[model samples]
Target: MEGTKPKAGCPRAAGRVGESGMEGALVWLIYQRAPGVGRRRMAQLMRTYPDPEVAWRLGKAELAAVRGFRPDIVEALLAVRKSAEARRDAERELERARRAGLRVLCYGTRGYPERLAEIPVPPPVLYQYGPWEPDGRPVVAIVGTRRPTAYGLAVAEQLGRELAQLGAVVVSGMARGIDTEAHRGALEAGGTSVAVLGGGADVCYPQESAALYRQMRETGAILSEQPPGTAPRPENFPERNRIITGLSHGVILVEAGERSGTLITAAHAIEQDRDLFVVPGPVTSPLSRGLYKYVRDGAGLAVSAAQVLEDLGFLPSAEGPLHFTPRGLTELEQRVLGWMGSAPWWPGDLAESSGLPLPEVQACLTMLEIRSAVRRLPDGQYIRIG
Candidate 1:
């Protein structure tokens, strides 16, 4: 949450323009629709004319005089300003968003994401659906391949669940494979999860993710820089990666191949100076090559969600309620722990109940004891502990 404050002089820093909340948002939408006005150009225009309304009223001569405004760019702005159709489009877009119950945030306005505003070329207009708000809690992003190995899937889901349980907001692109699992885990834990889409906030790219798309809109949020009704084009994803990392305090790469698009997210994280963590997959896996390269290049090695929370300074105090979930436990250990309760039970009884060999049960109990998750009593019984 550090460094998330909105920069001074951002457009509409005094909040919404006039009495209508959508008035400032409409100006941004109009500017965004202007041809040749990309992220950088839009940023420059906003810097020169903090009030977008002022920019809208500028004549060709005045607009052309602004820094970085070429003849063509100025002409596009002027044309868009003069076209009645352009204004109608912006108005219809806002009306549609309102009917859909979506919130439109113009850059530097109240309710806009402060972290996103800190990016070099933050989107001039953002469309969001949901009620979740950034409350200074840690925001961690989990990203990886669309086609992941079983190991990768499990790791991504477990990490998501643990991070959510620890009170950190989870973020991903809501894509297939790892991203889907990550969101699922967070929702399963009754925690917030945000999806940054490459298309319009209302569109779900992969038809298979329709369920997830709805769930996120209900429990978390769906965000996009693209306007309503915009399709998710191939090129939009790379640009969308920036918003994903820009909103996070840190990013965790679960599993990515050498040429995985997930690496794009990692690059954005590095450029944004956000903490980068990589969950090491098997070196033999083709999916893991990209992750190891980042690890070698100084990214933090993330073996567990707990380690990530600790590295990002999100670990709760010892005096707080002990809800920390242990990570890195073996499958057998997890099974044994699931069967444990506050009531004391002999190791033999646990083995019979869990249908595991007594020796293996005893070994798991010893490991659990060493981890301070269980305490052994003088009566030859064990009780679960924090």
Candidate 2:
């Protein structure tokens, strides 16, 4: 929301695999292949030499003269530049990416995510496997343990659906349990979602999510900083968490134990100065302990996706969902609320009037009551409140 939208009629440079774009991507791959040149070092190199072609042409002495380029790093870069094998490898990687139909986004490119660029040491190259581009929309990340409880799964899915319905992009690691549910909910609502993988954009981890991965590729996106053949190693996940939080305007933690790795994403959210929202779970569950600490430390308590949207300033005001009406409410809930006014109505009567099932009408009333958009009278009748 802080950045301006691209001017109308201006063409986007992202996803354009033109000759110049491919050449820039090749330079990034060459740097990535060098030993001891990690993300931070690569970022520093890009800062010193904004043009990869220029950096590629620099002699060893000139490379060594650059600030922060330690002797070993300079030697590594020089060796990588001269190695025919490294060049071949970089070329082979590009070929593989091309065959897979992946879009390679180089750092400082027009196609790169603006929010991600604001983070420290953003990925030098992002491999994207879908069509969803960042257009300054509200992107919120939902993350939690892979082995979540029933309650955690339900909450994650509900939040995902609600947020998607509000026209926000949902992001997650696409791991098991909560992450999978989040993606599923977003897709089910016919809304955009993105999965930041710990491995290659072409690879689907856990194997169980193969179907979900396909759905995302068609509807949302699969993103990764890793190359085409990279596997989802354990160490890569901690690093991958940074990108998850970096790409989002805020993060929602549904459930995590005391030492859950999900906390890594939450830490990155705080470090990156993004809003953090904690969903309160059962006090007896170990999964709720880590989140409670964040809440105690003043993280926003997320009872619903509408609350998150309002807190992040995505909503017009903080008066509650009903004030905005149809924006946050489900179709059924909207219809049910529309039928109610100052006069109290029973669930059966409302269902008959709206031509919906009694059970569904009852469920809608329950949700509306929870949202404080409607009030239940002593005689088991409901009336619209806000």
Which candidate tops TM-score? 2
Taking all chains together, the TM-score of candidate 1 against the true structure is: 0.74
User: How well does each candidate superpose onto the true structure, as a TM-score?
Assistant: 0.74, 0.74
Clashing pairs in 1: none
**In angstroms, how far off is 108's CA in candidate 1?**
1.9
lDDT of 1 by residue, 1-386 (tens): 11244334222322233322466677777777788888888877777775655666778888888888999998888777666777788788777777666787777456777778777777777889888877555788999999999998999899899988887889999999999999989989988899999999988878798887888899899999887878999899999999999988889998888888999999889988888998887778888887887788889988887788777644342333222235577878767776774457899999998899999999999998997667899999997653
* Residue 297 error, candidate 2, Å: 2.5
Question: In candidate 2, where is summed lDDT lowest over 10 consecutive residues?
Answer: 315-324
The per-residue C-alpha lDDT of model 2 at residue 271 equals 87
* Cα lDDT, all candidates: 0.79, 0.80
lDDT of 2 by residue, 1-386 (tens): 01335333222232335432455666777877899998888877877776555667778888887777899999898888667777777777777787788887766555777678778778877888778987445789999999999999999999999988887899999999999999989989988999999999999997999988998898889999888979899999998999999999889998998999899998899989989999988898899987898988889988998789778755322222322233478867766665664457999998887799999988888888888667789999997642
Best by lDDT: 2
